[model samples]
Target: MSEFSISDIGLKVGLEIHQQLATNKKLFCNCKPIESEEYSIKFQRKLRAVKSELGEYDPAVLFEKLKSKTIVYYANSESSCLVEQDEEPPHNLDNDAKDLALVIATSLHSKIFNEIYPMRKTVIDGSNTTGFQRTMLISQGGQIEVDGEKVGIQSICLEEDAAKLLGDKGNIREYSLDRLGVPLLEIALDPVEGDSKKIKKIALSLGRLLRSTKKVTRGIGSIRQDVNVSVKDGGGVVEVKGVQQLDQLEKVVEFEAKRQFGLVKIAEKLRNSDFEGISKRENIFDITENWKSCKSKIIQKALKDNSIIKAIKIENFSGMFGYTPFEGIRLGKEIGQLVKFYGIGGVFHSDELPNYGIEEDDILIVRNILKVNQNDAFLIIAAPSSKIDFAINSIINRLEEAKKGVPAETRLATQTGETVFLRPRPGASRMYPETDIPPISITNQELENATKNIPKSWDESLLELQKKYELNSQLSEQIFDSRYIELFEKIVGKIKVNPTFVASILCSTITNLERNGLNSKLLTEENIVKSFQLLAEGKIAKESIEIIYESIMSGKSQTIDEALRNASIETIDEVKVEEIIVDVIEKNQEIVKNQKERSIGPLMGIVMKELRGKVSGEIVNNLLLKNIKKKLGNI
Candidate 1:
């Protein structure tokens, strides 16, 4: 990647943060939000569009309908009910969730709305069984300061989270209802001006403010952010969804800004050209007979299945067809969405040809079949006759969008920080009243009570952490933002362990363990508290705290003694140390016989290995030198 200054690529970012509330039950059902039960039932369904109250359908919803997206829902009786499956009307909203939303709203200094109206936001992607998500605005127009700059808070909405989609194949998508209907508090931030650093600071500030309430769920997927980014040079808005990490958000924004900048440049270069109104030819033809020797598995499979191959003529896009703004995504991804939406396999272009066993003769043959000139790009899609027309239409639509610069679309985020087009951008008008749940009213008394009970602010938390735990400002800030801050305070205040040690492990050591693949989720606050209590009671070595934590994170449910034994970190016995030291001396008799001034390297390595993670390295070094000197007759 080339080095580009922040100013070189105009970066304007807005954040839509969704945090799941730690409610006792699902947003609309009696089932508990935190489910630990195995799924007992599974079923499949397809999403279809219904007209809005204005007697018009949302184009985005209709686009999904054309894709024939099907949904497969997995249910567990203990955690889900008919309400989640859309078979029954929802019960009353979860009050615990509503209360937490108010707590967060008050903490952010947002104005609470007197009447909360529940609305149904259209979602036809099968992530929701009801074809729409239940959402309601609670507060609006708050602001948070980042380095003396005010980052506007647009609104905060309380909504029910959608199901976790496991996977999709053909027209069917698998969903885990285990996470469905959890209450979520969504906070939208107004677009801020600055580089990635400032954007990150703003995001971190908001996240810490939310965590300060100590009322939100903490873990992977418990919180998500959607960023709507655009460049100053002019391009359509692109929404990136499900960004889980704050650091990754900066990278996503930077990358997206550059992507849009490049796209706008492309659009400008071609603006005056005659290719503006070029359209995709809709004529369909079978090219399987000519592609029998094709090496492309996708094409070969279609040929073997006797599927129809449809081609369209794209004008003045010969070399441009292979142009890519991001890795693994070409102009082809835009085209692929069309094919995916239309239930087709994929589309083939003329740019990277002569490779799929498609030779020059095949290219010429396709061009002749489509009756296009050399400067034109031809797209071919393979599918049954049932979907060939839709596929052809989708490809044409995508081509038209490509000509118009970056299309306004929603992209799904990957763990690697890349995004691909999920669907067209949803319109603002897709939201309507959710008739299933009655509108909730926020009483002034309730808001006042919540305000009174607001937790300590971030700066106050830092100061208190410093005063109570003897932590510096930097470490104190880290602990305040850590998920383990509450646990650290509980343990250190209850047990006699060193506060600094506890804080370090909670804020740093455990983070390292998680990066090494330990399941930190299993190591709860209670576990940490109990482990430290044992250490303070002289039941386990102080140095062995991390070892016990590692064991617990490795899926073992053992008492302190069992954990210590399993880790092989037994107390360093005098007899064992003497035996190991004598062995080291006997093996290195050559160095000892010389009786010259000795270097501690060889013996230090042997003793350290034997006592690793068991005793202090300093104690082992001292014992090794004492034993070595005794053997050398220097007493």
Candidate 2:
């Protein structure tokens, strides 16, 4: 990677960030914003692509339509409704969601638009019930500074999220509509002037700024990133999708840059070398019936199912097929991407053959069948006879594009931060006006209010929380970042207990509870507010918050009072605490004499365990220390 400079290669990278806004209701409906997959109703649908507003159809959507997939949509009464089913017209624009997007646009210094029109982005992959996602541009021409350099913000859009893909079997794909109508804030960053490393920094800086508002959802799948990378001599921009981690940003860009560079080199080599059979039908051939008794499981399965095998021979493309365009990714890996996108299982090329249980005898036959020399390579894929056209066309298209250079396509980010082909990069042909909903008009006063409503940047928020609530720096930052600051502030304002206590519960205790497999989402803010109200009334001990919360989350109690009853907690006043410590030390007097100060810790643990959640640990510690000294003096 150090061998080439990014500038010399003309690497231009842009980032598109999609974050689910923390809103009470779905963007276009009144349904609750739930994330769970459990649902009572499941229905199926089939959709096809049509021409876009420009009268140009999206090839990518057409590809999905060709697969003839069966889409199963899951819904529930609470989080999904007619709006998700497309049976009812969408409700009015969610002002709260729009306001949240405006707040982010304001913070990023974007140009607020007076009018916003929702457009339908063609997506027939069964991720949306309507066959297209509704997206509207809210602002443009913003900028954020990363490492003292300006990273231009191109545009900010508010869109409804797609359904979550649960699983897929053959042509049947499972989806859940619970996440379908959730509001998503999409921010597209302008192509920055830097290498892959600078791209990572720019993405992280922007993400932090968005998160600083504390109105964005924080968790896995709540935020997503799409990167568009292209090199100078490369064919076109390749969009890499679903990069969830900031750490993966650099790797994605690096691998893509390297990939384009290699593809360009291969193209140049093909242009100069003995590129032969120049426009001949001899490239793709049938070697199906020749391989009857292959030992490969993939081959065996296909043969058992009476499938056909197709092979494409690329003249002057032997070593190039196996060449590592990027670390851990070969040019052949690009072919594997096509197989997956086209719904086929696998593909084999001569470069990787004599392996995968294909004998050299089989290889010699292929070479003879295609009349290919040692310098030539052949690719093969097996599928049902019905799938032959799609598989063969995919291979032919990829090879023709490779000869021209890197093909413009959309890619999926892998676990290793690398990319695999997803589909051809859809162009302006994908978007059309959504006519059902009228355009939204924004007023100057509305924009001003949104700007004012913007929360403090993360750094400032941490300092303010620490000073006002006397919270530790770590706890204050966690409160801001966990999307808990709003509820914490509300509780502290209305209740009389220490603000630090609320912060501790919201920032630390609840987080720990979730890690312990307690569904903290089940324990709503109302639950916490009421529980704190109980604490203020001296009806429950602070130590019992965890126990009470566990009961509430586990469905043991629906109400705070009921949870407290199940907890069986008592105030255990200092007077009773002292008596308990006195009795405990008296019972363990011999141990106290032998260990003295060390005996205090063990005795406190024993006493606290016996009366857990009844009294504060601070009270227990103070009383136990005093008792331990008195008992030792008597000894």
Candidate 3:
């Protein structure tokens, strides 16, 4: 939906996907990777920007330090240790995780390094309990085909996952250590041609390939894709982090492309303009009486709380502050970023005349106080002294960058498909060897064995399933590519349940349960196998399987018969149902005789209430019809 053409936009996209490996132990320590409910440990710490060897600090680090961010971490002894909490040294790497990464790398045709060296990537964010993340390169320089065109692969790294961030208060961010130190396999790709459609195919192909290994963790938060996008028209590289769904990939790229393109246009227009190099003014003004009659409830409440409304003058920039390159975002968003980073409330600008009830007289007073000409823009923020200063300085810095074209940065994605600043892109200085974990070597024999054990290609498996099972291409492909494929085939081949029913329950029913907040993981593969076996043996009706699944998801661990006995309705014999229908008709004989067809409705409702969940509704309806006809004939 952007104004720019796909080709003229010149978008280049690459992906860095991280998936949790299904290992029994943590990547650095012997802690189990399973979920824990115990509360055993808690600690608080703060991260400071460390100067790189180049004698310079990362811009993002400097930016965060200005906001004074602190972190609080929570841990459980059952699933974490002092190593995860950064209170002690980490142990050697887990070999199972290493082997899994090697298998995946081999499948992608990547050439392994003779020796794998672990590196410490600097992450000052609170997501990592440790200030730095431990990572090691496994392989590099592979390729995959998208529509018969090769997209180059960059490198694959084995890293330890970060802790989960809980929430953030004024200066402190809370985190949970349950997911800390989980083994993560990070696969990077070379920049592909800026085709959004092709980028989508590449992502889907890579995801399916990873799932084919059958050793990666599944479900929400188990996998994440980070995209690095840039344009050839001099826009800086933008990193879009934590993209969870494949469907949103194209839209994200399109938005980024247009955003960069607009920034470039703005920079071109600002060339040789008098507003160049205008520094931010550090002065703060108390405009309480000026906005006394303001219509904005937000500003009025701020006044009541004794919060000051401060405005900064930017010369020669009228009519530009309200310019929007994307929906729901303005140049004002950059100012808002500072407000959030420093824990401020909100801000106002001069480009758009909001219905704030500022009379003509008050506007003249503000202009005279700031000495601003008609060609200038003023930024006004309502907050305490320190936060107001931080907000103004941040706005000036962003405006300066706008003159230089799009600034290269890393941003976080919101659920609404918008992006916010996370940090500046780190340079090569962030990469340093991780001294705790030793280098690992992959032998030739190991690669050969992994290749030999490679599962059948998804396409080949789909074709074989279609011919053998007499199914359509869509159903066959769905079965072949599903994580539940192995269990589905076992159920249909060993048990006597219909293949279609088994497939639908495994794929569709589980998806529906997950969407409805039920833990589909609780209904394990073994649970499905057992439930289908019971259905095949006539111990439960097919309709009752949904009840069994719901019961298990709700923490009931009984067998099919036990589950049924606990929740199912008692089955009424057909003769008993017929007798009940006849009794109901006799009781309503007056209505049955006068309106022969209408009496069946009340009789059917009564019979169904007694036989609910025990017998088919069709059988009840048929028996009700026969008894109603006989009663009317007698009358």
Q: Which ten residues in a row have the lowest lDDT in candidate 3?
A: 276-285
Tell how far residue 208 is off in model 2, in angstroms.
4.9
Model 3, 1-635: lDDT tens digits are: 13667688677888988999888689989998667555667788888878777777767667666766778888888888888988789988888888888888877888888788888877877778777889989999888776788877799999999888789887789888989899999999999865777788888788777776767776667888898988776468999997877667777777677667776666766665677655554334567777777767777788887777876777887766677655544566665664666677756778765436555665666677788898887777787655666667666777888777778888776665567777677788777777766777778887777678666555765677778767778777666656677677778888877787787787777777767777776776777888778666655556567777877776674455556777764555689878877877778788788778887787677776666556657777898888787777777
Tell me the spans in candidate 2 whose CA falls farther than 4 Å from its real position: 1-11, 35-40, 195-218, 248-280, 403-405, 444-459, 487-635
Error of model 1, residue 145, in angstroms: 0.4
Alpha-carbon error at 520 in model 3, in Å? 6.1
* Tens digit of per-residue lDDT, candidate 2, span 1-635: 22566678888899999999988789999898876757988888999889876677888887787788989999988899999998898898899899999999998899988999988898989999999899999999979888778888899999999898899888899999889989999999998657877887777677777777777887668888999988887887899999987767788888788778878877776667665532336576766788886677788888888888877777877776677644554668777778776678878988888898888888887788888887888887888877777777877677777768888888989868778888887878988888899999999988889878877765786687789989888877767656566788889889999987888888778778777878876787788999889888877778889898889877788777788788787776788778878998888888899999888778878988877888878878888888888887877
**Highest TM-score against the true fold, candidate:** 1
lDDT of 1 by residue, 1-635 (tens): 23345686666788899988877688888897655546788988878898888888887897788767668888888778999898999999888888888888887789899999999999988889989999999999888887788888899999888898788788678888888899999999998767777777888888888887777877678888998888775557889998988778877777777666666655665565556444443545667676676666777788788797766666676666676544444566557655665667567787777666566777777878778776677777788877787667666666666556777888877676666667788886688997766778888788888888888878876787799878888888877777677677778777888888888888888998988999887776667787777667655556677888888888775555667778887766667776777787778877766753363676677666666656656666677777767776752
* Over 4 Å off, model 1: 1-4, 278-286, 292-295, 324-330, 337-345, 490-496, 513-569, 585-602, 616-622, 625-635
TM-score of each: 0.88, 0.80, 0.82
TM-score, structure 3 vs. true: 0.82
Q: Which candidate has the highest lDDT of all?
A: 2
lDDT, residue 547, candidate 3: 71
lDDT of 2 at 347: 87
